[model samples]
Target: MQYSDKYLAFMGRAPKKIPHWEHWSNPDAETYLTGIDYYEHPRLCRLKLSQLYPQLELPIPEKDDPKPRPKLDLKGQSSNVDEHGGHHVRWGDTETTQWDWGKHFKDAEDVFAFSPLAQGDFTDIPVVESRDYSDEEKLYQEYRKMYPKEWGDKAPKGSTASVSFYNTMFMWPLLTFGWELFLETCLDPRFERIMTEFAEINRRVFRVFSRLPVNFVICHDDIVTSRGPTCSPKWMHKYIFPCYEEFWSIVKAAGKEVIFMSDGNMDAYVNDIMACGARGIISEPYTDYKKIARRYKDCFLAGEGDNRILYRSNPDEIRAMVESMVETSRITGGYMMCIGNHIPWNIPPKAVKYYLDISAELAHR
Candidate 1:
């Protein structure tokens, strides 16, 4: 099946089969893959593949150096792909070394500054809205190169857009201030100011999403923990949704579909996201898939198989997990089976194969 065919199904358009996608393992996952990769460096070919396809081993030249994997360091900075299609790393938080003296308010900028963003004042951002659009431009170009069918060239497969940018509301605060500081900031009198300025900052930076040629964008916000919303839902409505509301407004005007992704048990916020006009919802295991599929069948639903199962499950347990996800996901025509959150290297290869095998068998069933 052509890659685009499944994408067509995802968009509720006509297609050949169910849609599927996979991302490269993170740099750190290498620790678990050392045995398979053999060498210090691993190639893209060593990344996960569909069990449906025959394995064609590519010879690795001794001198060729594989591209480096991304990193998320302390202070909440990450060279993660969700930000810029892997072009740049995100920088937030600043004070990893401060003693007890740093907790109290020093000034407005301190409130804004961080383990990264604390020193940043809202007004300090230039009104000119300075940023390079080259990353988005590069993505557009890459899409044309890889999926020329979308651009109306002679087509190998017919599918819709899949790539997207990762943006968040509450996570940024968590990244900017440490968890404790961020939670406390929600109670500070200046909380609204900080949120507004950050939202404005996002407004300027995210203009690229609207201008891109594609009609789809992915957004991410890890707003909830395993238990429930980390902060009051009211705070999220007041401080967070406004920013997403504005961001979604731009995409809406551009005539695009947004697939929203998050980690945690955020069932309460599903309606909130739907209100933002998210046409698709990608979630971790914490969110109830069966419940959501029963409610939002019109919207595309992807990602539900928990990574923890892969990290620590026997073959029987893995089978049960896939069986349950398939049962729930198949209810909605838009479901795409994927490992929710992540698949760390520590996941047993046999278990990974088991997951993939089931996905291959039941993807379109």
Candidate 2:
């Protein structure tokens, strides 16, 4: 049986031709590449893109897809101006709708009084589930329904079964109370109980994950800004890292590897995250990929490629960027070609094509 490049890369085998796990979103670039209007022919545009860049995993819609609706009824209040009827168009599409940010809480006192376990339905929160995970078996059954019938409890050989949690330890408070309230109350002694409650909620979450048919779990938490850590090392060690160790240990014991994902520079906490039992990290371009490569030795790593280099539309810079990424891949077998900052709507189409072209030519061991 031939193993997939993704599975091989995840397992650190270093396939001859390195694979791509890009975070792409530039519909205008897609239209420019395929000459198909993305709004009119979304599926065809993606299919053509996938054909042009065979390494990319672009999803093809079954039919003409409509604009995505907000998951929660925010009742018209949103931190994003776009969600409040403000049109911010770039590259032929309006800004995507955003979820309500801290609309539930009136103040720090309200945030302090909130109990995550008591308010079990997180449907209103961005990127989390609506169901109550109070019962582990019930949560497991619900989560198990997400996988295919042929798989049972084990993932098919050469194929990966995976689940991603958006509100990992740091995000629970961030999403629940928004940035201001969380920061205001995080230093207070009262915040300890709040974090403990959030941990209990995640204990249910990770316990459910342990029993699922997944080979890996992508735990996402933007613990750091583009500069560095949002909270100090001391604070992170106190609340976040400990929970990461505890929750990840659950899935790790059940044979599932953890891939920790965060936005911004992870230079400060890469070692800490690794120590917490993550098999790898896939973070943004601000992170030092070479540092992680040198230290970890074939552990999975990506987000070295930067979209700023692509956006500049300079062929030499793009080529150099791809070359640097390939050099990192040489050091670590699990490296993937990814433009970590994202290829958003406004990035130049020609530049994206040039980046892809260079990557195809040189992203090989």
Candidate 3:
């Protein structure tokens, strides 16, 4: 099988052109690009856009009819209703977010009393949102089912058949205890036991990942915010980074490369993450891409492009952004063109056009 340029880029092979790895959700951009009404013909619109820009890897919908949207009570709300009786101003695919640690436990004391190993099964837990996560073998089988039947138990060489986990390490406690509770108790000596229990859980997780039929594993944990680290470096080294080293080591032993994904500024921890055996990082726009590219020398970095630039709708700025990305690509074989913050549903279509067209014209090694 012919490996895609994206797969090559993921492996740090430096394909002739810089690959596009985007977080896209701009329905208006699709309509503008394809000349199709997205709400009326969602599938055909995506199909045409995919044909137009295959590098974007837009998913081809299996159905022509748009999925049913929720009829929210928009009384006294600013959102306009569409002909389909749905909210017209969509910010993203859905209002629902993953890792919603709803009001399960009452307080920090309840969190401290919890034991991940004793629970063993996490389906009952509000934080373990992923299915089949309680059992390592079952989780492996579940991921195995996602790959093509032709590949059997192993992905083809150079294929991008990979798995991603949202709560890599830091998120385990954060999701389990809820944000405020986690912060309140993280520094206490008792928190070490909680972190230890969380680490044990991830040991099973990474071992399962090692057994999967994939070449890469994308591990996501928002260890930092757009500003900087949420937990200090000293605290992180004690609790978080060690688990990453141990868990990632499990997959690395099986010849699988780890791709560390995070949101916000990862500038401080990039080296630490790399030291933990990640092939590269895909983070938000707050990171220093050129500095990473120059230092790491093409270890698969992305999320340098900013959506704010696109939102501004300035042609020169968009072109300059694309050109700067291309310059970074010249420095590193593993650079991908990505708006780390994302191309949300509200961004102007014309700005999206300029970014893509300019990238096509100039984003080459």
Stretches > 4 Å off in candidate 3: 68-90, 96-102
After superposition, candidate 2 runs with Cα above 4 Å error: 65-92, 127-130
Collision count of model 3: 0
lDDT values of the candidates? 0.58, 0.84, 0.84
Enumerate residue pairs that collide in model 3: none
Clashes per model (N, Cα, C within 3 A)? 13, 0, 0
Residue-by-residue lDDT tens digits, candidate 3, 151-246: 765677888878888889898888877888889899999989988987887888888888788889999999999999999999999999998998
Candidate 2 is scored at a TM of 0.91
**On a 0 to 100 scale, what is the lDDT of residue 99 in model 1?**
25
- TM for candidate 3 is 0.91
**Residues 1-365, model 2: lDDT tens digits:** 98887887887789888999888877768888889878788888788888888787888888877544232212332224444575433322444444456877889889878888887767555535556656778778878999997787877766767999988899988877888888999999999999999899899999889888889899999999899999999999999999999999999999898999999999999999999999899999999999998999789998888888888899999999999999999999988988989887668899988888888899888
Q: What's model 1's overall lDDT?
A: 0.58
Misplaced by over 4 Å in model 1 are: 1-3, 13-16, 22-41, 47-63, 66-109, 112-163
Task: Give the lowest summed-lDDT range of ten residues in model 2.
Answer: 70-79
